[model samples]
Target: MKVASFLEDVKFNSNKPSVLMLMDTDFSKELRVVFKKGQIMEDHQAPFAIVVQVIKGAIDFGANEELIQLNDGDLVSLKPHIVHNLSAAEDSVVRLTLSKADSLQRVKNV
Candidate 1:
């Protein structure tokens, strides 16, 4: 049983946003992000699958070129190898859960 929390160190991201990694490991990675207006998460595709939950504020997710607005309480899963990007509409916070390669590969085979 291991527990982790946000780091005190401040890191700036796109649009002057900030971020924190609550947990990052070979098995699974968890991240907590704080987004400023106009902040964008550049386009990226992960080899492993991922789960994203909107913890606060609002965001728009572009998945496979399809756009959808996500508000608080929204949860979505990004399939392995899918092109995805994120942008914040307002000051927001989000949690990302990324699965390891081993687990993602099994799902791909099914």
Candidate 2:
């Protein structure tokens, strides 16, 4: 197993999102994305499943046209092909855990 350390502060540029690949293998990719205040990931869906965890600050989630607010320590999963989106509020850092479609669906249902 690989051991990783916790992240401290991160910075993002204007009109661009900051992305960090915390872990990546042939089967999956784990990322830590930082969105500045008022940053939005835009409205879209992914081909695979993704899990979002609010590490710090706050985030607004939009899925199926429904809005959900997430704070520190909160976690959420996105189903494949589901319409979903994310936005940051006042300097937020979100951890995105992405995995294979089949594996994610099985995990989600279990």
Candidate 3:
């Protein structure tokens, strides 16, 4: 069994969001994405589906040409090839779930 905490040793960056791989499960890769206010992960598309959950603070989730406000405890999912992006409404910590087939480098490149 693997154990991890998204909130543990949390850190943020001024120039970009901090991304960390929390664990690699049987079917998915769990990640912790920390964003300071106004930071953004610009529009990008995932080759596989993904799930994103707001663990703390607020975010503006841009997808489907819509800006969705996600507060604490909010979650969103996107299908493969869907273009999306994230903007922090405040200092935020997000939990991201990616398909096992997704590359960690692809996320880091964004």
Candidate 4:
């Protein structure tokens, strides 16, 4: 068995969003992403489907040619290779779930 906490040791970056691996399960990798207000993760694509959950604060999620405002406790899913981006409407913490086939480096690059 394994354990992790997204709320522990939380830190935010001034220049960009911060990504930290919370845990890796048999079929997926979970990440804790912290974004400072006004920070943005430019358009990026994943090779596998992804689930994004807003754990704290708010985010302006850009996808499907529109911007969706997501607040605390909100969750979203996107299909593989879909262009998406995120902007922090406030200091926020997001939970990102990636398929086991995905690469952590790709997320860190964004």
Q: How large an RMSD does model 4 have?
A: 0.7
Segments of candidate 2 deviating more than 4 angstroms: 25-27, 100-110
Clashing pairs in 4: none
Model 1, TM vs. native: 0.73
Q: Residue pairs in steric clash, candidate 1? A: none
Best by lDDT: 3
Ranking by lDDT: 3, 4, 2, 1
Clashes of each: 0, 0, 0, 0
Candidates sorted by TM-score, best first: 3, 4, 2, 1
**What would the per-residue lDDT of candidate 3 be over residues 10-104, giving only the tens digit for each residue?**
99888999999999999999999999999999999999999999999999999999999999999999999999999999999999999999988
Query: In candidate 4, residue 70 scores what lDDT?
Result: 97
Candidate 4 has a TM-score of 0.97
- Per-residue accuracy of model 4 over 40-91 as CA lDDT, tens digit each: 9999999999999999999999998999999999999999999999999999
Best by TM-score: 3
Stretches of candidate 3 off by over 4 Å are none
Winner of 1 and 4 under lDDT: 4
Write down the lDDT that model 2 would get.
0.73
Listed in order, each prediction's TM-score against the native is 0.73, 0.81, 0.97, 0.97
Candidate 1: regions farther than 4 A off: 2-16, 24-27, 101-110
